[model samples]
Target: MDYNKVKEGISLLLEGLGVDCNDPHFKESPERVARAWTDELCIGLKEETFHLTTFPMTSGDQPNMIILQHIPVKSICAHHLLPFIGEATVAYIPQKSLCGLSKLSRVVDFFARRPQVQEHLTSDIAQYFQHKLNPQGVGVIIKASHLCMEMRGVKHSGLMTTSALLGCFLKNSTVRAEFMALARLQ
Candidate 1:
């Protein structure tokens, strides 16, 4: 990432808005904002895709639904360039492999670090697991408060929910219901 260019752009933006960077309080603001964006906010732009570690399922291991609930979801909105903060629930029914538990949360963080819409984030996470594990089903749910909606558009604040379901999560009602129950969306 060209940190200097980002800093320059930020400075230009501030100056365009009539804020002088020479002002003591705002002197370091451009660099600070650039660092915030590069080092933290948009890390998905820099990091490689999360490597999901998998192990074969044993005959004795039951093929049951595995769920990780309330994993932190943080992302910048694609349209407004603001942030959406929430938690995500990722669940899947194993076919023959199990993903490393921590990798599930990593998946959420991996996809959520980019500028994205909640619906796309949910679907992408589900697709990653479904493609990686070849799971019998994958379901993802995100409940978030978008700063775009809450702070700007209508000035309302509430968690907006979105979901993506695949495989049996879409084809089987019983499976879907159980997954939804786990997400508290039933």
Candidate 2:
């Protein structure tokens, strides 16, 4: 992230908006915004920010549906560059391996930290597991309330829901039903 560029741009923006850049309260605002935006936009894009680990499924272990719900997500909407805060429910059936339980939440956070649309974010989370673990099926659902929608035009509170179903979750009704049933338990 180019902190200096962002700082300069913010100063220019404030000046254009007729906000006094020399005001005491506004003096460090540019630097503060730039520093805060670094975590919101840049940190998650790094490859090492979150490392996923999977455990091999044993011979006797059953390939059951594993669902983690209420995983909090905070993200910047690509369209408006505003915030959307929500919870996600992720479910997967392991064919050969299982990801750590806590990593499920981490995965949601990992993807949500970037500027995104809820649809693509849902698909990305499911696809990442599909690519990495080669799971039997993956299902991801996110429910978010976008600040852009409420704080801008329309100015009404609403929750946006999006989901991505892959493999068996896409091909089999039974698996999809089971995942939804468990995931909606909250």
Candidate 3:
């Protein structure tokens, strides 16, 4: 993250908008906003934050769907740079391995900290587990309230939902339905 560059850019932006950057209330705003963006909003762009660990499943264990729901997500909108706050529901049917339950939340946060569209965010997370864990199936759903929509344009406030299904979740109706039921998307 280029902290200095972001701070300078923000200061110049404020100046260009006729906001006095030297005023006491606004003096440190540029630095603060830059830090907030780098540390909180766009942290997921860093590759180091995406490590997910998986454990081998026993041969005799039944292949089953695992669902993790309502994992909190806060992401910046790629179009507006404003925040979209949401919850993600991720489900996977293990092929030969399973990850820690908490790892699902970490995965959600890792992808959420980047500037993204809800649709892309949904697919990214689903594909990630599908590739890394080689799950039999993966499903991801996100429901968000975008600040750009709530605070700009028509100023309407409503949740936007997006979902992605892969592997068995995409090919098998029964498997997809079970995941949706567990996620309360039915």
Candidate 1, 1-186: lDDT as tens digits: 688998989999999999988999999999999999888888877888557899999989898999988799999999999999999999999999998888999989988888889989999999999999999999998999999999897999998999999999999999999988877843
What are the per-residue Cα lDDT tens digits for candidate 2 across 1-186? Answer: 566887788778888999886899888877877777775665576556456899999999899998999999899998998999999999899999999989888888888887879999999999999988899999999999999999999999999999999999999999999988887787
- The sequence of per-residue lDDT tens digits that candidate 3 reaches over residues 43-156 is 887667467798999878788888988899999899998999989999999999999999999999998888889999999999999999999999999999999999999899
CA lDDT of each candidate? 0.91, 0.88, 0.90
What global local distance difference test value does model 2 have? 0.88
Off by over 4 Å in 2: none
Best by TM-score: 3
TM-score of each: 0.93, 0.93, 0.94
Please give the clash total of every predicted structure, in order.
0, 0, 0
Mark the 10 consecutive residues where model 2 has the least summed lDDT: 41-50
